[model samples]
Target: MASPVSQKLEEKLVCSICLELFRVPVTLPCGHNFCKHCISDHWHKQEQAPAGAEKGYTCPECRRAFERYPELEKNVTLCSVVELARDGEARVSGTERCEVAHGELCPQHGRLLELYCEDERQCICCVCSIRQCQRHRRVLFEEERSKKQALLKESLEKAQEESERIKQAMQELEERTRNIKDSSEGLRSVILSKFTLLRKALEDCQWRTVARMEQEQAAALGHVGENWSLLKDRLDILGQHRERAQRLLACPDHRAFLQEFRLLPSPESPEALLPVEFDVASVVEPIAEILTNVSRLLLEDLPGSVAPKAPEPVGQDHRNLTFNPETANKYLELSKGNRKATHSPGTVCGRQEQGPRFEPWQVLCTQGFGHGHHYWEVKVSSHSVILGVTYHSLPRERQQGHKFNIGLDGGSWGLQVREDCYLAWHRGQAEKIQEPLYKNLGVSLDYGKGLLSFYGLGERTRFIHSFHSVFTEPLYPVFWLCEGRAVMLCQRD
Candidate 1:
């Protein structure tokens, strides 16, 4: 190994910006030395930075300011010393790098890795950059690090959100399981009481019918059990990812962080939550065929899950929605019946601000839903429209860096209809859903069940997506219209 004194001299010859040994060393007015090209490139980037002042030729190391760009003088003495240090160290330890070889050194080149190779997905040294990866995509290690750091944060956020969704689903599944068991037992009691008044022959039929009902209960419970296991597995995966991401985010060493990030596996895409409904009516209807007409009468009065249920009428809960004019932005125009909203920048809806009007190009519905099944339909002229439900607590003021603030927080959820896909936005995270554009869209809300679904209206209502969450307060339907986009609330008698 080379002596520690030579290693210290080599470290002194390193440029702070490039973190590499000086190439063509130059001295600045601030008494700091750096590579000639490195100092020039730094000043060039400073000039191109936005909102720069008249003069900003500041030294990166000492932070000393200069009125004008200073002339770089080649430090011939320091350059000669750096060369002697390298040659002396080479002779002291033949073909062995002293200090740089200890950590993050190129095994083949024996140089400190300063650049990141995009094509190879690894950090590379100076020699590797020109020799093997000259034509490959190369960037500064810090540049690649910042970009990956952003992605790491985004992935962590998604894991937290998915974990919450799975927990809620598990709770709902347990509650539904309990209700099925109670309803099935109540029906058994009714059948047993009816058989006691009949002869011994009827008692035999009662035993068989009760056995069939028990079998139906077991089958329904088994289906729910399978769904519960699926959600459990997904929750475990998200939890592990969240823990690892947190640790990586806290890592102080950029090299170690980047290395671990490359090896981290991506979370799997979430699966759709299957609809949990058991057809109790079909199982009970067969008993009518085995017994007298009285058996059919006993089945009619069965309650809840024990009885046959008619198909829920989607139209019965249809809501007539209208835009709240006071909450509309200046660029949005409301129709005479307040059923249509059109966005046109040239034509102002109202110049003066009225009430807590939306600063973003958005509007809120006049009605809010609290506790029941509700369905509504709307026709959009084109894409670039956002329709969703939000709480009244949503800020009515302007939002920064965003055209609309519908799904930027926890109080709101939105489905942005893009030209090629749909983006489900909640809590500032967007989950993209790819689907063909549909003009007529339907929104269904089951408040008691904590389900909100969106559908595309065509030959039949096509199920697009759904969000399950326990909503605390009443939700109002909100909308945003881009320039030249129009949304009309479809009228249904």
Candidate 2:
């Protein structure tokens, strides 16, 4: 639907380098039109002239040297004319006249044979061709023009194909980007939800632990305060009795009053006062029992089931086994069959001893406290036998804890404590055995005449001046130290 001139103008207006409509059109002083960006980029590259040449550079099309700035700002009349032609408004005017001989059209081509040289002004008809032109070393205008047209046509087709491919690629890229955005949004939502749940769980755990600790602290304070009040009342009564006795002695009836005072019973010895055992069993035992039941239920049932759940709370029991140092000597003596004839001690049952009164102790059970590691402290009193601790459930090669052969060279007696407060002692310095200390506690050792005591309950064990006696027996409930170590000690109650 467009005129031929308009189409031709559109084709010519396209940039030779970019093969697109010219943007920021500019012209060289020689009158060749090109996109401003394209020409300037080309000029910038050539500005650094070849070696040994003048610093000034020349136009690529016209070979005319001009100042750099002015050349860059040259008016582009040809580009404007081409644009107008594309819009069907261009007029051909003020152009150099075509130089043809006698105004005759060429015989080979109907078009006028215009002379392209600036000087010499040679003009000839197509019929009368010059021999110099036929055999000329330089390229003829007609041949050069034809070659340029063919190259332009090829470039136009290639550019069109490339543009189409780029458009398709852009569409695919947009689609993929949108999908990635959607996936990112979905993942963000899921992470936020999980974070919220975890925060709430953490808050609940904090509040529960705080409440339990506060209750225990309050109960302990109240019990201690009551004991203090009772002691104060007893002291007051003793003071009153002492004052009355002093007054009677002053009155010369001291002997009679003394007799009356003797009728009153002596104050109870503080040593005889039995320590109050709060029997935390009521509170802690149920939880432990429940956890044990839960463990049994879980272990007994098959992996897949749909029925009653186990009593899982037993798993929370973290009480560690502790040893009594005084009992170690008894165990060592029993292991050596050296009990005195004066009294018969309890029988030592379990595996028979193959060596000289030394055996290993086995783990009875293991309780886990899911939150963190737990600890126990044991003390040893006498070291006449070997003592050791191990987790039998674990691999044999992976046995852990301390073991010592006591009294081998008549060294000072020492005590060894296990991860659980289980204790053992020897009569002499034993071989130093590295033991894995509990995660949250420290170990302490004390030695006295024929007694060696060890403690492992963190820093607090250092402050414990006294201990309450509990039931003690042979290694029936616990394991035997056949290969590792064991100690002899008297059973305590």
Candidate 3:
């Protein structure tokens, strides 16, 4: 182990910037030594001062000023001394060393800094405190160390809590991703099953059509065979008559020929044959009808049959909705997916002025419901926001502080959330509520019953407020946001 003298020397060689033995120490024009990076950062902060103020550089330790920042040069002597001190103290006894080596001895009185001056928040030696810290509150070195150690322990506990919270969030995210994959696979199976049913229906129709065609073919061939039999019998009788006449003519007697002709029975003339017609078009008419029916059933009936229905619970009327860009304020930016809305920093006018847009820092959803119960949620990112439902005619043009804006007129109703409290607004009326609306809000609108409700959906579902109104026009999901704030429509299955 090194002696106390060697430890004192090592303390003097440390740099104040990093609070350690100096490496490549540099000196300022103010005659103060520091690590090069520390001094550079100090000057950089000075340069960032407000415009039109005095442009001057100040020493980090002494607060001495310079008209212009000087080019820093390496303190060759201090650098060499710090290196030697580090090498010489390689065999130091313990790691419990003083934070500020300069504190080891007072600059003015050359004594140990065994006391802390609470008023100045600095360490001072007994002799120096008597001279400079005469009126300051003071504590012994051990007392101050104990107080700091308790505070450090508390900080460590808080850090551990924060770390555990992060781990829980990560696990939740992984579980949610797995759920999405499972849902997609399930949907795929349903779609394939529906198509398979459709294919089976078509195949059944095909077999029936083929059977009907075969039956018609057999009947047509049977009719042709019957006509052939009748014609063949008539031809055979005529052939026998011709053979009898030839035999009488070969007898060489007119009397014999006349007797044979007279004796032969008279041949009857065959009736004219009727044309057999194949009605191919009539035969395949059923096949054409089968094709049309299959197409109609698949396109019209299958979707409604396989589609999932929404639950009718208070907070379960989940709908996939998007914000309408045409209805957004010029200062508000809607994301490409239309799921999120935030304030834009630009003042340029680009969007067309049309549709049922909210001119007073608000925007409406793309779809509206006129009947049945609908539910949706929004993830809020700001305290100064209003979420609610409104009619499509809720004034697109800006008016002079018109009470007709969202939550302020008969056409709209809203829940306004602030950092500390919440308020329900309708037709220029406001009601104060004690509950805190969280980051994620669930909105359920029962249009038929005129019941509109809001729920805070973080950790647990907490009902905030509800509104009842007479039936009128369709109601749309609307939001009002302050500048530099954002809110997103939550997507759910």
Candidate 4:
């Protein structure tokens, strides 16, 4: 009932492999036609050979095989029918027209094919090109294809090179990052080690300082405790005495008790029963002795020796002592003397001519009193003999309030007159001289203003007159004793 065209089209739809209407038409092994690329792709996927050769694949439907190429011509009738159908489908889908200039058709050719002209700015088929591409350079499809092929090759090579470079760079960056991480770890370890050492050192120093402070504190506390105990004992004794006195006084017949209490010496005069000389020495010697010892100790510990000793409580005698003559002399001499004498006076003086022309005195001898004031005396015979003190150990100056012998070379003997002046001599001279030169002698009468005092037999004994007034300048205590006649006395009272 259908038309011839419809019938032919129906026949064209047969499957080449099955020789029937094409239903999922599949290709055969003899280069025969089939549906789409179905049978051919199947054979390729299965890794099979063509159907015509001796070892070719068999058809899935008929199992046919050919030893040689089969008569596998394209079905003209079917092809014609398919072409017609395609044309009809295109008409329905709307065919695209060429976008050439002015809708012009080529005078030489009627069919259209995609082609380009350099200046046309649009696509043109072969027919449209002869008309629109007159003034523009034409690019044929084949030529355009060749040019694209070359460009594609170059682009592929460039892309390959770029990809390789990117891969290499990534590898290098990874290596550098790893190295940086390793370096950071190493540095961290070193820093931690150093910090640990420092921490340990700090802890050690802290512990040492703490230990030293604790020791000092403990010693101080012990001393304070001992003093407190002594004070408590003394208070108990006083309390007992008070109770005894109160009980005796409470009775109406207390005359005998009153007499006994009166006979008991008052606490204020505790030294009444003790020897006077002992009392005096006990009171004064502590002061002078302490000064001498302290001054010597300080000198010995010059330039900061071991940690300074604890400060001992000052004794009663120490409180009574005034100026330390030796300390005062050293302080004065060091200030006034030249730099050479200040540093090493003994060394410098030993090298001087005739040993500096002045005799060096043991101005601060430690033998007499370890910690108290002691006195020395000297006698004057002719008066013309120059008597002065020189510190072979150091120099002397006025600011320290010291005065040595009376003679020339800035000595106290130079004719300066005033009151409240006194002379000091050695121990040997104290007993021999009953009267002072100021009372009898008249040689150099101009030097008669200053008074003289002797120290011997445990006391200051005599007085004399000299040429000087009150001593203002600091002096070294060296005297010129007359050859066999003069004497020196040492005493403390």
Q: Against the true structure, whose lDDT is highest?
A: 1
Tens-digit per-residue lDDT, 1-493, candidate 4: 6789787776666565445443223344544556433455545544565566446545656767555433333343344344344442232121222222223332234233345675765556443554567667776656777877899999999999999999999999999999999999999999899879967975785576457556656666676676667667767777777877777777576687777777654434221221112122223332433333443344334356442222212222211112122332221122222211122233322231322232322122112222222223333333322223222333333223323333323223321111223333221121122332331111111112122222211123222322222222233334322222221221224
- Per-residue lDDT tens digits for candidate 2, residues 24-117, read 4676676766766777776676776688867564565676887665455523355435434434222212221232232544444332343322
Candidate 2's displacement at residue 471, Å, is: 32
- Choose 1 or 2, whichever is better by TM-score: 1
What lDDT score goes with residue 191 in model 3?
84
Q: Pick the candidate with the highest TM-score.
A: 1
List the global CA lDDT of all models. 0.80, 0.41, 0.74, 0.39
RMSD of 4: 27.3
- List the candidates ranked by TM-score, beginning with the highest: 1, 3, 4, 2
Candidate 3: 10-residue stretch with minimal lDDT: 305-314
Models ranked on lDDT: 1, 3, 2, 4
lDDT of 1 by residue, 1-493 (tens): 8779878888999999888778668999889999887899999988887874555889998899898889987676776576555662243244334432455566776655667899999988666777899999988767899999999999999999999999999999999888888888888888787666565657766787678768877777787887788899999999999999999999999999999999899999877765666655465456533442343334433353233222233568999999999899888999998899999889886646667989889999999999988889889999999999998888988678888898898678899999999998877879788888899998888777556778888776566666655565799999999999999988788
Q: Give the per-residue lDDT digits (tens) of candidate 3, residues 1-493.
A: 9899998888877777678676557888778888776778777877988999876788867988988778887675675476456553243223323323544655665443567888888888555566788899888767888988999999999999999999999999999999999999999999899889977976886787678767877777777877787799889989998888678768887787778778988789886664666666476554543543444354335566432222333445578899888888888888889999997656533778775555677888988888888888888886888889887878776667652277766678899988888988886878898896599888887777556778887666777776766446788888888777899887765
C-alpha-based local distance difference test score of model 4: 0.39
- Kindly provide the TM-score of model 3 when superposed on the true structure, using C-alpha atoms: 0.36
Candidate 4: misplaced stretches above 4 Å? 1-111, 118-123, 248-493
Question: Which of 1 and 4 is ahead in TM-score?
Answer: 1
